[model samples]
Target: TKVADEKTCIQFSIRRPKLPSSETHPEEGVYKRLDVAAWLHHLNELGQVEEEYKLRKAIFFGGIDVSIRGEVWPFLLRYYSHESTSQEREALRAQKRKEYAEIQQKRLSMTPEEHRAFWRNVQFTVDKDVVRTDRSNQFFRGEDNPNVESMRRILLNYAVYNPAIGYSQGMSDLVAPILAEVLDESDTFWCFVGLMQNTIFVSSPRDEDMEKQLLYLRELLRLTHPRFYQHLVSLGEDGLQMLFCHRWLLLCFKREFPEAEALRIWEACWAHYQTDYFHLFICVAIVAIYGDDVIEQQLATDQMLLHFGNLAMHMNGELVLRKARSLLHQFRLLPRIPCSLHDLCKTCGTGMWDSGYIPAVECTGHHPGWESCPYGGTVEAPSPRPPREGKKGPKVPRDGFGFRR
Candidate 1:
């Protein structure tokens, strides 16, 4: 098996596809507050409407300025449509405000017994997670901070709104950044809703959904980094399953990158300029760029987990993003894309293949990493408890660290 794998690896390396043209763009600075106005100005003019494409391209190349991130993220997250006029958006905002108020009122209107049931069931989990979400951020720091309470409120409302999906542990991590950016509770709630509903990465993850994504990631690894894939496959199902990337896919790298850089990465991902499955490329990029030595060292599964865990806040987000973009370009240029890959692309977004077809890649039936998805797993729902006094990271694995099962 090793000999055949090595031969296959070499064959893949020699035959790796390349793009016909490798055009490059100059590094433009962050899209500033003025740029937002410019885009909106074009939108307001009768004959001079701006294309969402230009804005998405700008964000894909250069990230948005922090000053304008709150303004821009709504469009990126699909909270606000690009075609909507200021007047229409104002009406929409009023409508949303009313809807939010109604949601809040539903909580107020719950019977004493119903309230007890909710607190015992849903709000209990939200309270525990919100306090730990981003306590280190100044906005959420200190005792009895109003922002913390606001976060709790927004999350509770979300639980009430989305009772079927309910509150999950990583949700607070996702909501905290939006709360910090948007500041207003109603807007934050709406933005979080948009994020959960629209984006591919953030979801009420099911075990099947996560396994499907890992399978796609495995195929991408096999295609782009054959030697690494061969080494992983040699280690049996544990390696090929890429369980270490669960955190990356589940939380969208919130714990992996620095706070600012994580925010930047999220916006770039939400831009939807290239592919909805860019998060998969990010998974590939991390292993490709930093874990290149995994195959060389022949690290086992646990050691690989430890190595990736230690990369939290240490990775260059910009560099990983660049590598991911390059890998996507390479995948698009492949001569005969595999059928499974085509299925992945079509499922993810518009298929990126040019033409030609090939049989699906084959693998052993010993798939691992199927314990449960980050969302589908049974987590202990801590009872409604007091917020922790000081700042601390979420109690989950940051980058596949401390995850054993």
Candidate 2:
């Protein structure tokens, strides 16, 4: 291999496998429950793909002369620090505080009819039957709501609000985050619908719109998770389309991102006006960064249902978002990503947004996150995928932290 001086450079490439572990506990126990500590240990070692590369190169090329660059030292020191980007992120947060304050202030001045018209144009629908599940038992919850309606009414109004991708089942979950963010449920739900429509489809059956979005997602999954795609194919179209991904396309980030977190994310964009790129970048990053791990699990289980059943779990939200943002930062470095936010406006108008709401059959039928992928194929009990033949990553120890199937 050529170095700058063609010295061969002892060129060694390290393809990180997951930290090695032994699953010798053949028959005695259950699979590893989610272990954050152990997982972090593994991640610290395995995910150091960037750090290790830098360290190794410095050692090889500069030897002792590699006097650590002082300015670069902080990033180097905090490479694995948990507060990864907290300072800059906080600055974004401060800006959001001001924007949200203004949005709330503007809402204060809207007349009742004007408020109704504003939401209606945005496509919000509020009726009797569309109640929210989480709010059902909390009698005190909606006291501050500007408009009184059943959770069903609230949800349905949202469906109307974003007719491009209407009434997906899990859409309610997306609202939870926003609902948490806003003191007024009515306002929160409507704003969420507005935000969602801006990012993803909201269920319009008109002109094959839904189908196209479905197909696009399906194709992306094919590239991102072939085995998972195969599993969805095994279940037939209806199962995959109806059960699994209903809420995903409709609510977009509203469903998956929690409130405090959602506020954090939305606040940054409100300040910097960079939400569109951030959301798209994070969405795609999920596909790329976690693709291999998630795919491996689904392939092993061969159970789409199982895949979806545990969707909400497994993720460390703050950490995952950190990785997603990091990846987005990297994306900006690419020629294709964008040289400036200036180009982002032109590109969005004609590029991805104009592509219309093309849908794809996402591996659904489960919950969200990583769970059983029932759409994958018919399930065989207990063990789904074949035994580990040859694979990357250490064999996660059974009954412990490293235990990943």
Candidate 3:
């Protein structure tokens, strides 16, 4: 069995497919999956595509198929990059396995007195969430299901792996889908790491990181939908708290959308071809989609919370994706973006707001940082900038649900 598994991993490495060409863009309004042939082609040309930006473009336009998600998500998450050769990738797989095992061993070896309170908190928090992570989904449902045990092991191990951000409430929600798809414990662990690395602000110890994200989300609203921003502001600082939108940003809307649809939304956000903050744009799209209802109904803060909370398990993922794209197009056409916002874009390394438009070259192969993609292209490091000082808003509780105090 060991030999067979190694052979399978090697085959996956060598026969990795190339991303579909731009000419193969899915028909308008169609959601195309990355098929077998396309996957094989991408693997064959992994080295060449790494030299360019084709893979990112392909994913941006067409998400990976559910069948290939286990294979494709690793690359998307930067577990593997375009530049890795078949041999190098196999080696990486082996090394990653050993590293993950070591992390698990360390957790076992620790004396209870060494990290008692911290480990207990992590274990208790994770245990509480695991049973409820996605109980409605068959994958995690049932008493004493093996899959549920797998989820528990991975989350506990993750807490040990990254102690800095140990076991936040929504982390289980974020990891559940990856575990459902990847199935393998180690691969899922690494993929979850990749995801956290991309959205680390969501789980940072400092409230300032989350605060910055919320501030940016608000600014984005003010820019793209001034009326909505004004309406929220008119409600006072508590209203501007945007507690409802926090989980959408924090968990990438994983809790709000159904299991399958949440995966689709994540693939789009992970593509990062449109904007680094495309997920934020998706939030704006959601608000825009239901904007009329809020306006006409004159929703107070409590009422707004009720409305958004109810939207969970009820959103149209495709519609929200389409509207996000439309909003991006509209944002690009603005005459001038504020320098502060541009600085924010640079800090996020989205490059979307750099010129108030996505560069045409992003679809082409010549976009900036193509060379550095493998080393650090997944999420661009924010450039150094002066500290931003804005009128401080009221602090909201950090609970996963968005409800102001």
Predicted model with the maximum TM-score: 1
1-405 in candidate 2: lDDT tens per residue?
212344322222212222111311121122232134322332343232234333322321222111222212222223223234446534544664465455555655669996687566432433322344345424325654433343444465544444555554555554544444343454454455454544334443343655645654554344434455565676566544624443344444444555444433333232222223444433443444334543443322323333332343333344444444443333222221111122333333222221232111123233367465533321222232222323242232122111111
- Model 1, span 1-405: residue lDDT tens: 011333243111111222222311113333442365565654655422376676676777667777777777787877888778777777888999999999999998999999999999888888888878788899999989999999888888888998887787898899888888888888889999999888878754564677778877877777777778888899998887676788998899988999888887787788776577778888887887777556766777866776677778778887777666666655543333333455555544333332333212222223367553322222332222222223332322112111111
The C-alpha TM-scores of every prediction are 0.77, 0.38, 0.76
Question: lDDT for every model?
Answer: 0.69, 0.38, 0.66
Candidate 1 residue-wise lDDT at 273: 64
Expressed as tens digits, the lDDT of each residue in 1-405 for candidate 3 is 011333232110111122222212223244356666676676654332342245555665567778888877887788877667777877888999999999988888887795687557788877788888788778888899888888888888888888777787887888888888888888899988898887433554355677767876787777667778878998999889898888787787887887777787788778766467777778887887766556665667866776777778777776677667656645544433433245344534433433333211111122365553322222322332222223232222111112111
| Best-to-worst lDDT order | 1, 3, 2
Model 3's TM-score against the true structure:
0.76
